[model samples]
Target: VAAGPAPPGTAPGGRRPWRQLALLSGLISMDSSESSVISVLFPALRAALGLPLSALGTLVAVGKLAGMVTGPLWVMLAQRVSRKTVLVISSGLWGVWSIAAGLSQNYVQLLILSTIAAAGFAGGGALVNGILADLFDDAHRGRAAGYLYAGVAVLLAVVGPLLGLLSEVHNGWRYGFFLSGAVTVAFGLLVAAFFRDPGVGAAENPGVGAAENPGVGAAEPHRGGPARPGATVLNRAVLRELMSSRTFRLILVQRFANTQLAMVSFGVVYLVDVFHFDNATASLVSAPAAICFLIGTALGGQIVDRVQRRLPDAGRLLTWQLATLGWGVAALLATQVTWPSIGIYVVLFCVLGVLQGFNPGCNRPILMAVTRPETRSAAFAVMLSAESAGWAASTLAIGYAGSAFGLRTAVLWLVVVLNLANALFMTLIHRPLRREALALRAATADTHPRTSGAENR
Candidate 1:
């Protein structure tokens, strides 16, 4: 179909953007399946490999550290190829490494293979975020992100218990890898056949590719020439522009300061180790917490969208800051203070999950707002890479600290304290975020004057 201006309240992907969103979410879901399996089944892994607690940290760290480099590399690769091609190869076809990792009989082999798989998985985040920005306009980006992540959370909720059940069988973690790898490969095939590129800036300037709307769509001028495969390369000027944005820089710092990943990565292990629960019993928390997180994302997305409609400038940022702060409080209560029952812990974790959902629903839309469509993939690549580095550092620190001190104390300091600090740091972004967002709106109006009437609302 010819690309042109999308109708009001419609996405550039035509009438069925949710279908595209679902496919993208399914692809992105595989990105973390391997890591989740490793995290959830670490007890079995530890027993089988005679691994130390710190080894969990090392394994997770290696994958994340690999992602820190490979994430950006994949984004650059997408520019050379196409986002769909790179996404399929990295997120889908790379499942072969996952299967190989599952076959490993030793820690070294497992680590090496999983790292290779992770390098491929890292490609999905930047490419998907960039595409989503083009698929939906700013007004609905939060809801789009919410639905995408909520889908992921739903899968995690279902899979978490199954992995727990699998832990009961000898070498069941291997089966988890095998299953994840197979499913990912299948999804890759589906994406290759069905997924459509909305073209860069298609949502913002929907009139793209129309007779009168020259220099838009896939070959939009600001994004550089036509949509020839392998024609686009890394644009250094765009990178510099991204770096110059005070809001973008502050967002990077906020992402780097995030340590909440450690909470999810280690929560199951903490219950198994500290609370003396079996794997099956400990995993019960995962399903409910994930469900709550799904609710959080769904609700948070709608709430942020409405708030932005009213406040525009401060809404999303304020919501994100408050959510971060709330998550820290929940983490402290869930971790630092001992509860008498696992049920209590479950309820608290549900609260944590809900608060956790708010961050992505808010921050992702903010990132899209502050960036030009041309620079979005690179922006997300850098931002997500920073987050990967932070996750690696936090996981490693918690692992060693859990050994040196205790998991309880380590959780208290790293997850709770750092999250609180990050929330406070987010305050600095308010002014810059407002300024940059307004500037982007003005620029979009100038570039697509015909759509300015609709966009100004």
Candidate 2:
């Protein structure tokens, strides 16, 4: 496989790359905050509506289901239109739905509005992951993902306290939702007006190759040539090719199993219910964990990148991924034991946060390595859809289980078992990774002969 020279914006560079990273991270943070905010505001929402605790599960499940359906559609739209255009439109529209959700008069209306907002939120991961791959080549992807996700974690941490305060007010949760929606809408417009779309394979086709195809990232029609060939084409054959990869399928399954943790949707609730912390205290306690998560994310990404560089054909990335999952399983299992004090629990939470941090840096880099650029968005769409299904399944199951068996028991049981399953599923990806990595590099070279030629030179 042609592992050509490192592409542009792939490593230490100027502020432009950081600026792009910050913008994309901010977008994702906004989307992620929606999911977190709901959890923080759940108790208040339930009290106001006179709803049972189980309603939270339904709320989460419905949103996940909606995301499952719409994720692929966004991928298809991005294929036909500009990635930037699709993202701007989806983000803007969803922001409207998000705001309207706050105004819902009843449970059903709230559910419906939240689901609509989720449908728009679902598209973000597919678009952003695909775009990031183009912005930074393989060498730098780990650190880039780490920084992006760390920013998200930090941002969410910062807002969690505010949301907690909102929960104390009679109708304050509504304002939190309204504020989130308006901010997202504003960011969406900013992205539309200012965000530049890096070419589809711009990182891989650096130097003169990239310059020759300045229009690669846009929605404009190809002129006097066959369609510009890259890895991210949308069609049956491409889909089939993507599906055929055993590593990719395993990656998807691992993702599915991981989502079964359901922590993101219910973590704060677990802390409150099990530890007897009030809303504000629960949110505040979780804040430090987010900082730990950020550090772990940054450190883990750097370690994996260094490991891969030193052991190119040794499959160190797989080792790091599996290790991260193993750590997660252990940390989660530790949470099952009733802790003697809040301090001990916070320590466990921080450990879990670090484990959680390891994943973001590893997962997409694996996907990008095993697949080509044209297939990347489709690959992400499928991945996101599977993740949504997992989220729906886990949220509903845990939500109901929590209502019956107790939140702590239900969450702990699921986290331990499902993460173990995910780790096992990831093993199947191990043997195939080298082969897939070679295939992706070969395909990239084949798709862009100029890149191959430059590598040869």
Candidate 3:
């Protein structure tokens, strides 16, 4: 009841601290930022390789697909190995590969190494989000995550342009991997050596990994289980639970549709071809948006925790989605308005950044709520699969559309349509969110009878 932490030796507030949450959050974020980082090198790559326009385009798609494949392998391995270790190793590998990429001999070598490095980033991301679920209370996980990613959004905005500027001078694009890899390895070592996951109800446990029900005593050391015969098959129970729960499905679908719209690889080129802005100008437009996104994420996380404390089943989650949906639509519609100056584009971009900010704040908390703590990693891996698929498909679709109908038309159609479809996804989980809200309330009451009276129904 007090503001003081649950106990010494455990995660803060019986959950992890923001610093404790950083390594994975930081490392994983770098993974999903291919759009920002890889784009800086494209012109250099084309000039050096003497490749056609089509060849340059294929690099992006192939890299993402490779990431998707590698992601689940990491998640599955997490069941057998420490999630922390996998992330650390992957990030280490990322560092090595990034440096290797910078020194590649040819197009084929560069392409192969690029895919491998990005895949490490993607898999590492899944591990970090899973760690968040393990370390936090369901009530507060979303907001906590919001803070973590808000920090990342800021980095993307800031580092993205710096990477571009470096690319311009002294062939820095070739060395991008070297810089990223060195930093990544340093981060992985620190995290592997020190990080932990929080289990609930354990008053004095450090949060490297949590117990199934932390409100109780420590769990028996996982000595032995049924001979985990088959290759730890993708846990279907994780899917069934999500499928049965409306909130889970809605969040996942929203994530899917949001990515399909302006959120996907679409942003990198949309500014370039449609808005006819130079790369530096596009990054300039994007940077403010990144700042706004960070603000939105922090706000979302704080608000989610506050609102739930009062109305356990408030429509705040739905509200966030609706706002995001509007932003997507507005972004598409913004394309229609002919902006005369870099100033106008900056204004629109900042608005877009605000909308982008809403996602890290709103989305992950919902996913954690829908899946129980134990299966959080698997649940996220499944969603990661969906996210990767949406990214791949959207890239392909937009590519064809741009070649045929024009970038402007493609952006317009996808943005508006995906916005509406994504908003409707919340409807998919309507009844389930309500049901889960009640179930969570009951569970809370059963565990903490004294606090139940303080919690509003």
TM-score of each: 0.93, 0.90, 0.83
List model 1 lDDT by residue over 99-180, tens digit each: 9999998999999999999988998998898888877778788888998888778878988999999999999999999988
Model 3 ranges with Cα > 4 A deviation: 1-16, 33-35, 40-44, 47-57, 199-234, 260-264, 309-311, 440-457
- How close to the true structure is residue 88 of candidate 2, measured as C-alpha lDDT? 81
Residue 159 shift from truth in candidate 3, angstroms: 1.3
The clash count for each model shown is 1, 5, 15
Clashing pairs in 2: 231-373, 231-374, 231-375, 232-373, 232-374
Q: Candidate 1: worst 10 consecutive residues by lDDT?
A: 209-218
**Candidate with best TM-score:** 1
Compare candidates 1 and 2 on TM-score and give the better one: 1
**lDDT by residue for model 2 over 92-138, one digit each (tens)?**
54698889989999989999998999999888888888878777767
lDDT of 3 by residue, 1-457 (tens): 2233345434533444556776556766555444455664454455666754344446666776776788878777765655656777876556778777888777899789877887777776666676675555555665778877876776677776776576466657676667777767777777766665443222111222243323221122322221111112355765576577767666666666654333435564566667787666665655666787777787867776776566556455765666667776667656767778777777776677666666655567666655554556666776776676666666666667766788677667766667667776666665677678678656756754643443332
Local distance difference test, each candidate = 0.83, 0.73, 0.61
